[model samples]
Target: MGFRQRTMENLVITPAFWQDRRVLVTGHTGFKGGWLALWLQTMGARVIGLALPPATQPNLFELTGLAGQMVSILADIRDRDALAAALASHRPEVVFHLAAQALVLPSYSRPAETYATNVMGTVNLLDAIRQTGCVRSVVIVSSDKCYQPRATACTESDPLGATDPYSSSKACTELVAAAYRSSFFASGDHRGHATALATARAGNAIGGGDWSTGRLVPDAVRAFADRRPLLVRHPEAVRPWQHVLEPLAGYLILGERLYQQGARFAEAWNFGPGGETAHSVADLLTKMAGMWGGGATWRRDDETHPHEAQSLRLDATKAARALPWHPRWPLATALQMTVDWYRAHLDGQDMVAVSRQQIARYCECEPKAVAP
Candidate 1:
């Protein structure tokens, strides 16, 4: 069916939909969080960001200058008291929880910190919502890695488990959400009258402005920028890559569903590309090199690192059918947009305008409606 010909049975975006809506985004200084903050601002939402200080130099948060766009709070998610105070003062209508020790390698180095931030930090946010009694909906951002190893594209109903510290901690966060939603947010519970919570599993994301150390695309870009050979680990491993905004749009749409349907829509959802394309690290590097005009090369990392998933893909059909969600940019276009952003920044273009322009471009291309 044509995009416009499809029925409007699911939530979709409009310019003024988020106007006057209060949204609290944790991890606003991080890569995906920064993008979400900027997107919400474009929708005219009142966004308040809560997270630890932006990471050291070469950070996406600082690179995008997102702190100036929202009420950025310098606090750790593990600090329940601080998080609670911020939630109470802000009284957000919707909360997007994205703060965590997001790196798998670092999680191996500091397993305890990972658990504290990912597992307990989630508990803290849930407890704070219980206290505030003002939050209407919350979307807990998790990863496709939360699923147990499977060669096929995993669905949301597949068993949930994780091998590494980072993935396992996210699994624990999912458990926390399940428990709280069942125990406290049920129809008969005291706090059930106020809030509904859900989880979203996003596939591997790639875009510009990401400067995180150890990530594939960012590492490649940084090494190339410095005229060094990028290191490639697990070059044969496959991932479902899409632009960052694709999943962010899914999260916001799910948030809107939770607002309308309340407990009925409070369930786990997957946001990813429509199909599995086994784009390995080598394949991604080749794509990036081609997009960057052929001056980049890579070598395998010598030191042994934590194990990441060998192959990963997700089935977002449920989101497509239930929420009418569809990915706008295909794989090649996503990579080109990423490379173009980095090129613009390196060429001394105004990055703030560049980022905003990308956001506008994505929205304009978004499919307004679709058939299941």
Candidate 2:
């Protein structure tokens, strides 16, 4: 199959496409991966999750009861033999490679571990996939920070560079994917074993069930729930924030295209909210405080911290034109959804049902233009 122009009407994620398909999701215990795995389950995919135990105490993977839903394998991606054995046994038709050292501040303290996990971990997965020979579509999740720091929005064509260890590792991860794609999974290979592989770079994704340390939304949720003030670092740092579902939707669509359309869709893509959604940390916190409605507050931290990017944006025009994807929820709605999820959790509500309801609502939402 070859790539064809898709209309907005058909851009909605097709549950029929994923139904009963064998899918492998690495990092299924993390926030984004958890959401993706849950969504796949809802669509009746036979999901196989391979990753270490949840890193945080109250992580989404356990909170949502995902272990009971899929075949959850406790293993590390850095372990080459284990990873290869797992892939060989499961033989998934689709793979979403998301396991990595995702946090930036932590990367400063654990640089070697970060490189080994993000860079070599990727090498392990790609090599395993090549040997396993059952995967037809692969979506490798990278970060928008893979681009060199710039004041403007970054396009997929932008040069890949990074100042921080986390970002540098992600750039190297991208290079590894590109190398594997070109060498083993090249488009239209005569050997007839080519795999359609693509990379997705997304902006700051905020949502519920994310208790990871050093994140804005989770920290705010904890502080507000505890009746304490949230401390802010780099309050003026600007990020193109969107609900987690936005990029997850992009990943699903990209995976589908890679499976059905082969080479044309096998390339790097950017999935981000519109430019108008870009806001400073302070601005986001203020809005979050108002939404929380309990006098939740934040103050700038005086302690010196490791360097972080002040401004970052992504140009998702390629995805918009090719996959015909767009942000369905605006920032205000996204923040409200986040607050609502935490409030439900605090109230002892069933988080899996709440999360599933949000996913259904997101799928039903019509694409709206970003409000300035």
Candidate 3:
């Protein structure tokens, strides 16, 4: 059997199986968030987006016209009262918290904003969950940077900490999640309300509709389209690059388990490509350019290098084994699909439908979990 067929044969149950369920996404307008929202909508879920206004020009959220499809709320996760009100109003059965100050270089410049948004924003949202009393499960979207750097692959048991403000804040958010899971939502606590929570640590995700600044794919695509050489900062830096949908499929599965198993499945998990796919920044760019027709060149720009991790990857064996989650698209397929999306968008095609078509391909290939 092919991987998709094998995955389907081993299937126990999956989250996309949920139909018309009330789902709340915190950063619904962001790149990953927008993709997740679109995916959930395809699964027939009632999605509610809670986030501030889009940050940059040509945001993925607006590009896909997501606000019209779901109940979009303009609010900050840092504001405890507002967050609480939204949660209480929606009474979401599943919650995916993706809101935060996510940039690294920007974090260095505005450490306080980064800390406040990433740390306090998490605290506020978790506290809001406590007040809501109806949220059954939560999937907190964290980063591989949250792993305390060591010489080897990081399992969930590895120390939880960060080297920079952005990473450190995510670490703090994980700690807060663990505390909430163990303390209030401990197995037997009546006040705990049986709320299941899981944190997903994914590495660098690249795909279409990602117009964020300081990211590699969008920068390279724009430069190549403009017939200019792409500037490379820290070209030697290695990362665990995967398509945006790969880890996102993992999160949806985690969210499903959180609702079904509650305390039993509450933990942190990693969602990244296997070791062979992990390569340096320059390596990925070279691959991308070659696949897209070869006129692009990269120039080293050390003066503008962002404060990013030198080398980072996630061990997704736990997800693969437990959730029956494996990356559906190979690195080459991921890059090709990503490039195709940008090309279509630039050519004035319907981005939302184009994005949805990609999603359908992925879900068809998504595996069903095997019995433990």
Instruction: Give the top-scoring candidate (lDDT).
Output: 2
**For each candidate, what TM-score against the reference?**
0.92, 0.95, 0.92
* Backbone clashes counted, model 2: 0
| Off by more than 4 A, model 3 | 1-17, 188-193, 304-307, 366-372
Cα error, residue 342 of model 3, in Å, equals 0.3
**Alpha-carbon local distance difference test for all models:** 0.82, 0.89, 0.82
What number of backbone clashes does candidate 3 have, counting pairs of residues 3 or more apart or in separate chains?
1
Better of 1 and 2 by lDDT: 2
The local lDDT score (0 to 100) that residue 120 gets in candidate 1 is 94
Q: What would the per-residue lDDT of candidate 1 be over residues 179-283, giving only the tens digit for each residue? A: 998887753332344688899998889998888887888888888888788878788888878899889989988888776668767889988884455377888
Model 1 local distance difference test score: 0.82
lDDT by residue (4-123, candidate 2, tens digit) is 112223345677788899999999999999999998998889999999999998889988889999999989999999889988898998999988889999999999999999999999
- Quote model 2's TM-score: 0.95
Regarding TM-score, does 1 or 2 come out ahead?
A: 2
Candidate RMSDs in Å, in order, are 3.8, 3.7, 3.6
User: What is the lDDT for 13 in model 1?
Assistant: 58
lDDT of 2: 0.89
